[model samples]
Target: MSPRRILFIQTQGENAGAQEISRLVGAGLGARGYDVSHLFFYRKSPSFDAPPNTRYCSHDRPRGVLGALKFPMQLLREIRAIRPDAILTFQHYGNTVGGIAARLASSAPVIANQVSARMLMNPLVRTVDLALGMFGVFDLITVNSSDMLMDYARYPNNYSKRLRYIPHGFDLKTTDLTKQQARAAFGLPPDVPLLGSVARLNAGKRLDAAIGTLADSPDWHLVLAGQGPHEAALRQLVVEKHLETRVYFTGELPPERIGDFLAALDVFVFPSRAETFGLAAVEAASAGVPVVASDLPVLREVLASDGQPAALFVDAADRCQFTDAISRVLNDASLRADLIAAGRGLHARYSVARMVDEYEQLLRDLLAPVPQLAPQS
Candidate 1:
């Protein structure tokens, strides 16, 4: 028998959370004898090398109006060529455009993966998504957070029936580098207390509040490990507060260096204003680095194990609360040990193997042959 072919469709092949999930899951399925492939709408990020079996609808940065008009035909062509047994999609463009293309080009079951609640906040986008759900454009819709699953279930009509909850998973590999070695890689001071965040430098991330925490803690240095549109503004904030020397910007670290970045940090700070799944925080915990994060419900869901919270939760907007949480984790020896222990526990809670198992079962159920009924007498 031939191996089942599964294709993942996403907006771009970037080093983001959704892309990472697809990479891990795709690799897992391939190991299990499935022929896994990826179809990205835009060109791959320069910092992120495209994995094998990857295809792109556009070979450059997202084209403007002309690209949007041409995307359907391009996507349809790719779908026809792949001829996957089932299709899984990520991001808004993939969920809508990819779903439509797969429906038209193949008879595969289409699964739309929603990793963010931001789309639901937009009335027009939400309306369109619900309409597509009503029309059965997607066979299933998966969410990474239970809270998001509930939110989608509340939509008027029966759109809720298609929703499934599957939390994001991680490999949780142990870092070989020690604190001093990791710091040396980034040219950071070996002795200074360090706070780090591995996230896009965006306004919604509320990274400015992280800068504010730095101002209050004179002894601590901050490292912003990712890049985005807000980088220039954040650099200015570091200068305005005279923290140019204390704040380090490493741009975007490739996947291999993420563990090293986490190893060098005393406390991992995630002050995002919103997140559907607090992937970075969970990752920090997996590295056994204590975490200080926003007190969001979704964070509460993903950052807990056996009813114990793995992070120091705070109002990320409040400089005092944010700084205080970091201070407590640093100053109290027992608390730091406890948080680290709790964090290590997350390795099992969000194991990549477990996530892959659930996904495989879902595909099997979707592809199972329906029983034929007896002929009428």
Candidate 2:
């Protein structure tokens, strides 16, 4: 039997969580004898290298509405050429446009993967998604968190039967580094009570709240490891709060270096106002760093191990609550130990291998079976 050709379409090729998820799933399937390919809906080439057997199509258009409008046709052309067995798309623009393109081209079974709940905020997009679903443009709609799935279910025109929740997997790296060694590698002071978070410096991430917490607590330092459009504003805010010397912004660490960064942290903080699935928090748990995250349903679902919460939760809106949670984790040795132990239990359920296995099964099931012919009549 010939290997299944699975094509993945994503809005942007940037080094964001959705892009990373697509890469991991696509690469894993390719390794297991699936002919997997990835297509960027927009023109700008991604900084990361393409996975094996993956191809990126360039349709260079200036960013924003113009580019989004032109994307479906470009994507349709690619789908017709590839003639894939299955198509999976990630993010808002990709899902809506990719689904339409696949339908137009008669490409394959379309799987629209929603990584964030951002779509709910946009009425137009939600309307388009519903239209696509009703028209059978999307064969399946996958979300990473149960909370996000519930949010979509509440929509008036939702295609509830087509929705599926598939959690993101963590590909943890092994790092044999002591706290002191890890701090030195990242140029962080070994003595300070370091609070760390790995996130894009975006408004939704609510990193400014973390900076404010650091400002009030002179004894603690913060290290945010990631880059985004909000960096300049965040830096200015940090300066305004007089946290310049204490706050360290590690522009963007590569995948290998993330384990070392996690090793150096005293506590991991995820203060995002909106998070579909806190992948970074899960990675921190894998590293045994006690976490303090926003009290979101997605966090509760992902951070729970054996019916116990692996990480501390607090409302992102309440800065004091976030700080208090971090302080509790830092000041109580027993609490830290308990959280770390519980975090270790998450490794089995959220492994990259497990995620790939589930995705592989779904893709294979979606593949169109060969047509049957009547026996000699």
lDDT of 1 by residue, 1-377 (tens): 57899999998777777888899889999999999999999765678656679999888755689887787788899999999999999977778778888889999999889876764345766666777788898888889888888777787556778888888898674579999999999999999999999987778788999889977779999998887779899999889999998999988877888999899999999998888897888999878999999998889988988888899899989889899999999999999888888888888888789889988988998996646688899
Note the Cα lDDT for every prediction shown: 0.86, 0.82
- Give the TM-scores of the predictions, in the order they appear: 0.93, 0.91
The whole-model C-alpha lDDT of candidate 1 against the native structure comes to 0.86
Instruction: Check candidate 2 and list the clashing pairs.
Output: none
Per-residue alpha-carbon lDDT of candidate 2 for residues 221-299, written as tens digits (9 for 90 to 100): 9999988779999999988887889999987766777899999999999988888888888889878999988887879
For residue 244, model 2's alpha carbon misses the true position, in angstroms, by 1.2
